[model samples]
Target: MFIRNESFYSFRRQYPIITILVAIHLILFVWMNFLPFGNYIRALGIGYNLAVANGEYWRLITPIFMHIGAGHVLFNSFSLVIFGPALERMLGKFKFILVYLITGIIANIATFYLGGLAYPPHLGASGAIFGLLGMYVYLVINRKDLIDRMNSQLVMTIIIIGLVMTFVNPNINILAHLFGLIAGAALAPLFLIGAKPYYAEQRVFVDHGEPVFDPNRWQKKRRNNKRLKQAFWIGLGILVLFGLLSRVL
Candidate 1:
């Protein structure tokens, strides 16, 4: 008996987190344009000093959803359309959203701290988009069959175009892009490792005609078997520590 493989529509139905994130980003993009001096607006389209002084510290994360202009929003949103669905399908909605927000915040903190406290206000989801790109690159590097199927040359071409754009666009935050890419690459292994046992167990259950487990089911067996919870907590702790360090020292 042949079992029917689920269609892409089904996969997307299971992963609404990406859709929500993209929607939020588009909303912020429109909101940015409506505010005064909005062209320079970043997080919540507020001034940098006001954002910093008013303790609107959440701006760091919120900024990741904002875009400077139509071109900026289009580029990042397009990249999200390309990568976000696949990642959400692979990692589940919760994990995918966690990775995006964490990487984006880290990238912004790196830019704010290392790039100079007085650096111009910045906005855009490019950092998170770049993180997705980096994660995809890592996955391709590790999976030879996938790399062959997708064509490494195509990946190279995209990277080259991004590099050219980085240099050509003076307004682009190259530092944020670099930091996001590096952080994403580093964290890719954690998600990949966490996913392996789950996939392997799923295959085993399917082969044995056992009841397939619900992917989102929060059971002790799934949680403990894969060490996913442990990895997530550890990763969060590390990120929090890094954020504190960046602010203090």
Candidate 2:
């Protein structure tokens, strides 16, 4: 009910990364629970600290798609729907994807090293979800004039509730959430600048019957679409290199 029609109509078009992410999560969840290969998929994707320590470093990334049960995936998917599209619209698809992946992997890494090797191998996308929430919090704080103060306050409330939930769920890896939030905050400077000039000006307008960030910022420095693209590839490369190193060393 809170989502605007324009935003909803343009969600898939403007936020393809969010769509792809939700699709992947749903597909994996369904494949793991309904299909004959469910167990195999779970075995391959679920994170296990010992497995990671043994050089199965893919665990760092794969667990973002793994869930313990219906409740887990449902909660995460709902959170994504609420937060992902807006962030994607602001950061553009490529940069948003990079933020997601970087924070998520870092969260999992934190879990691996600090989660105390508990049972069940800590899985799910809560860390990444928290990352988006953290990013939103960052934006709300740094770009206060650009965002509605009321909305920012609401997000702050939700973040606090989310954090509390992290603690309430004994099965949840609080470290992952904490680290992911920290990573999102640290990485915000790389992404808070929009790919379009409107992003800098915090303006919006209709473009070819669709809405986009202000294209009339009037400053050449305000429009830098390459920043997100470049950051995406660079961050991806770093994650890949780190994963490989985790496996080798």
- Model 2 pairs whose backbones collide: 198-214
Give a tens-digit lDDT track for model 1, residues 50-145. Answer: 455557787677778876566556656656765566566567667788889888988887876777757777777878877876776787677443
TM-score of 1: 0.66
lDDT for each of the candidates?
0.63, 0.71
Residues 71-160, candidate 2: write the lDDT tens digits.
667667767876676677677777889999999999998888777566357778888878887877777778764455445655676677
- Candidate 2, 240: how far from true, in Å? 37
Stretches > 4 Å off in candidate 2 = 1-9, 117-119, 195-249
Overall local distance difference test of candidate 2: 0.71
Candidate no. 2 TM-score: 0.75
- Candidate 1's C-alpha runs over 4 A off are 1-14, 34-55, 145-151, 194-249
Residue 211 shift from truth in candidate 2, angstroms: 11
